[model samples]
Target chain A: MTGHPQSSMPGQKISIQASQLGKTYEHPAGSVVALRDLSFQVHAGEFFCVLGPSGCGKSTLLHLLSGLESPSTGAVTIKPTSVGMVFQEHALFPWMTLERNLSFILDQQAPAQQAANRQLARRWLQKVGLEKFQHAYPHQVSGGMRQRAAVARSFAVQPALLLMDEPFVHLDYQTRMQLQQMLLTLWQEVGCSVVFVTHDIEEAVLLADRLMIMSRHPGTAKTVLQNDLPRPRHLLDLKTNARFIDLVEQSIGVIRDELQAVD
Target chain B: MRMKDFAIRTLAPLGAFLLWELCSRSGLLDARFFPPPSIILYHLIMISPGEGIFRDIGASLSRIVLGYSAGCGAGIATGMVMGLSRRTRDLLYPLVAMLYPIPKIAVLPLIMLIFGIGEMSKIMVVFIGSFFLVLINTLHGVVGIARIHHQVARVYRISRRAYLRHVVLPGAAPAIFAGLKLAIGYSLVIVVAAEFSGADAGIGYLIWQSWETFSLKSMYAGLFVIALLGALFAYALEWLERRLIPWRDDRDTREHHDA
Candidate 1:
């Protein structure tokens, strides 16, 4: 389901670099620290997953990267352009059909080149196996299908950096696996960089080229694991590998300990 | 199944009309004051299409259309400003609160003095009555749009115009439509009342004239016309709702079907 070759290749080295990034919320009582002096780098064409316990500001990091919120301190920079984000909730415009949602991103581009944009969107929709459901409204489709459409929309613009915040957290296990496979296929086809934030250790280990686990609230990077798994990985084969399960268990263990310490 | 549901709905009205006719004919009711459906229908049929009655219907319909459109437009505009801006809310809330409690009909005489006893006065009365309800509802609707949706729009880097077009309007549409539906009912009621008091050519005027002439059947005919018009307007809005917000209907259908 691959389309034409990349129009322009991304740069080598760090595509996105964050240094001393921090976010604090000022409440009526006082300030609550969400992230403090957090720094990370995502290379171009890499699947980087940020895994942590709930309330660990993993989503906060993603939000900062997505330009949804400003950091309290420090800076984050990406070479090419702003990042495209996929929310945990499939933030599809409920007013629009799936095709129209994709068209919206393309429409934001130059108007005179719309025919080309439409063709690009159609290619991406087919890449996600949503060609049959292009005319369907978001509400009319299943949750997994909606998320796939969301992915298609985010990638349709060929963003330099893609940020996903626990996008498959709400789906059933089977649907989540299927979508994970679809996502990998799309990423391979497009060669776009992704910064996915998830609480699921299995999801993190299965999809990420490099997985970074975060500590408790006022989050900081505890460990960064570079997954040396082979490319064009199959989900079923990846699951059967002992190394995959070991990685998942180790990350889950870290998260559980963090939860207990918080309690 | 659909036909069965339709028949079941029609049964109640049909039975009530039959009972009314039977009661009037059996001398169980005062026929002078309480004319049966048969007499009302007779007068309705007897009234010529080109006669003054149709002209009265036209006048009443026109006044309602004008007043309701004005009220809805002004109300939505003002309400959006008030709801979206803290300064506007502070400036207008006190005045709205003070005026909301006063029955619009209570100021009919004052309105007549200001706008005169012509159509202007009646339409002004209707507008005032309808506007406040629509404004308050629309304000609440605007205020009720989830903050999270605005955040999503911000993340997308949607331009201000695109944000309003894609997010705010759709998010607030259900509430706005709800308000409009209520405002439509208010307009129908107020317009008739205003027409009843002074207008010379409206359904309400015809009703008053019939009452003066002691023609109960003709009065009931006018009342019937008013009811039909009100129901028609409501149905029309519902049709618009189905068309404009089809997603809402689809969501509801899927939810119930899944359940």
Candidate 2:
């Protein structure tokens, strides 16, 4: 399914374009296909969520889009100058304190304006509600805090495209919701295109402007669903919305069938 | 909070020393042979600080610093090359395996013949002794870095420098530190042994001289100093490890059944 373009011009609307993206891994058993002939476009400043079962190549697609991994076949082209990524594991540098982790990325930029970079990092940390924990190491913080710090670090770099691979998978329900809201708020504030991968249908419904569901083993996009939910969505309000539940149930049904086929 | 833990931890060493003093005073143990902690301390103090002990410590420490630094530098470089590239790993792994088992100390005479009975021989011995442990540890550390980290760096289009700084170093830190700690310990062992064999100055030389003269108290004092130096070295590495890789402690507890 396709929705109305948010912008009039093609150049303005498209942020990322993937053509026939595919990835295959060689194992002792034989070649395992993760993605095959996957193609999609993510619009600028839009939150796009890829929904799939556990073994599906949803995360693989995210990696390829972020240039983290090379696709065996096909290509992903991004209009953005650079891509920022948040991993499922939080991938926070254990050796660095939260502030230093952000600074490390900032330090990569031309060394002339380090003070400005540090200020930007501090601002990002504050945006993520982690200002108090800036000095804390990743190990010292809670799982949710660590993920928030990871997100903050990614955002501090100001990449035009953000890739999130199940970034909230490790958090408890309440923390996940809080982080989901924070992510949406941050995305709105930054106005950068985001491609988020997740197994949770509710999370996708709550966060994504458009959701793409995929089948497992040799993953391919099965359906793309556009959500007409209003912006500035509250977590409680989304849960109570009938359209949200219907979309979630519909996605869940597709995933269930995909799981059965795999079994 | 941590200070209390530190005090409690010191209790065991204090108790051991107390037991040693009591046993020696009661004549249950030969003070001449074992030397009570107090007597050893007194002997160490009565000896002129500049006579030879300080010189020996200085000489031994310099050799260790030089040898360990060189070995660690080479080991880390070799390890990264082998770990990152399949070709290098294939070429070097077999050679390392073959040489690793050959006790480095066994080649001391050969080393002495080649480098002579000078500081070079002693330093080379320490280098060989330390290099293997560091190399193996570094190799394993680099190899063990999670593939996901590499992917993350790739996603960011991280430059080679950034990749090494962020992905490689942090990922391999725990293993590298483990190897470093082991290499430092091996350095101490080999350096002392090398000194014992032929050194004109060093704590090891002092021990040998005392033994020849049947100065049992002085020998025990030298032995005690050696043990103290070894423990101090190990403790210093542990402190550095804690400071440099704080995350390792947390990761260790989470990954292992025993923290």
Candidate 3:
């Protein structure tokens, strides 16, 4: 358990550390365990991937890490900074326009000036290539555009650790790849630690600096694989890169073994 | 296309009214009971300062304004409180449930006895009717907001006041508008009914007195006025709803709900 958040070992370049973390939801029939003794560390400025199958509590882990839900057991320590998250559903406030969504977060994170936030929100939208659709409501635009705005809103705050829960799972193949590249570019620019959870091995392998593979049924980290692929990885370049292919295959094997062990 | 649509809408209703007038004038319909439109129009045109028609309309409208405002205000406040806190919902929900189902008109006799045959009695009936409708809808609006939205607010560190203003209020607005619209029609009905029994100074009284005095044209005139008022109120509320919630789309994906 953590004694104090800031007084912890943040000086050691650990962006976030979760030790002996577990979560059990209390229901009418019985209590369902979602996470069990899941321990991991995301270093400062690292792209950490939590790869697991559906129902493996990858989302619950993200929730726990983001301080949305408290762990039933153990503790999560992080350098105190406003955390930003992207959900599978985009989770942009549907009522708010694209610009307002970014500005809403900016207002809370950077309470400088209204005009400054407006300019910053516009800049963020421009970065996501959504400047033209700044006044458009979430449903007014296409799904990809909405997700991009969501991404912009998350990054607008300039978070210390960004948590993504299968953020591109709903997009079409082309959009998904395009967004994956966009995410890499943004991550490269911001240099923030990211804990991305996804079921797709290829996506995890493509994005993660270190992939943490989780076993199913009350998810626990089975193994953590280091991605030795070279930096500034383009999706097109990654396709021909033998190391990328190898990492995907390696992560797939680990996931397959995890699924097999349970059966 | 828009002009054609407007023409069609206006012409269809005009055609029906014309047919009714023709039928009544041609002796196919009873003019005594179902008076022709032209005579009702004449009676409406004849309305003036001395005729007490304006006073009746004024009496009815003031009751609606006072009661509906207070009722909707109380309902929304209570609903928002209940929506945000489970403890408040647990405490107030059953009380609301028990109280809401009882028809306000049914309590007219009781209210008249307590509040007396005055403005308070009339206004109170409308208030009760409006309060329940708005409260329930506002509660549904708040509770129905996606769990993910709440999580978004927390994860982004949205302050409680800001969350309520930006999320909860707007989130519940469509449903609250639905409730407000229902309450308008209900308020009109309750006011008219309350006036029917105890008052001598409303559209209801005008209609009732005209009937007793065998002034069928005036009675028809009262009915016509009520119809016009109903349309006016509905349109006003609809306009307000459109202004407040610009993103109320029928075809919006279910994943992202009402603003």
Better model by lDDT: candidate 1 vs candidate 2 = 2
What's the TM-score of each model vs. the native?
Answer: 0.92, 0.89, 0.94
Residue-level lDDT of model 3, residues B80-108, one tens digit each, is 99999999999989999999999888899
Off by over 4 Å in 2: A1-12, A259-263, B1-9, B47-52, B246-259
In candidate 3, stretches whose alpha carbon ends up further than 4 angstroms from where it belongs are A1-12, A258-263, B47-50, B249-259
- For candidate 3, write residues A1-263 as lDDT tens digits: 12222223446588887888889999999999998887777789999999989988999999998988899999989884868899998499888999998898788766778789989899989998998999988878888998999899888888888999999999999999999999999999999999999999889999999888887777777788889788898987888788888888887887776667764
Give the C-alpha miss distance for residue B44 in model 1, angstroms. Answer: 2.0
Report how far off residue A2 is in candidate 3 (Å): 19
Candidates arranged by lDDT, highest first? 3, 2, 1
**What does candidate 2 score in Cα RMSD to the true structure?**
3.5
DockQ (C-alpha) of model 3?
0.47
* Tens-digit lDDT track of model 2 for B1-259: 8999889989998899999999998999987777788887887878625446788878888899999999988888888888889999999999999998888789999999999999999989888878888889889999998777677566656689878877787788788888888888788888877888888987778777888988777777777777888888889988998888776666656544321
Model 1 lDDT, residue B32, Cα? 84
By DockQ, who's the top model here? 1
Best of the candidates, TM-score: 3
True contacts kept of 1: 0.42
Model 1 vs truth, CA RMSD: 5.0
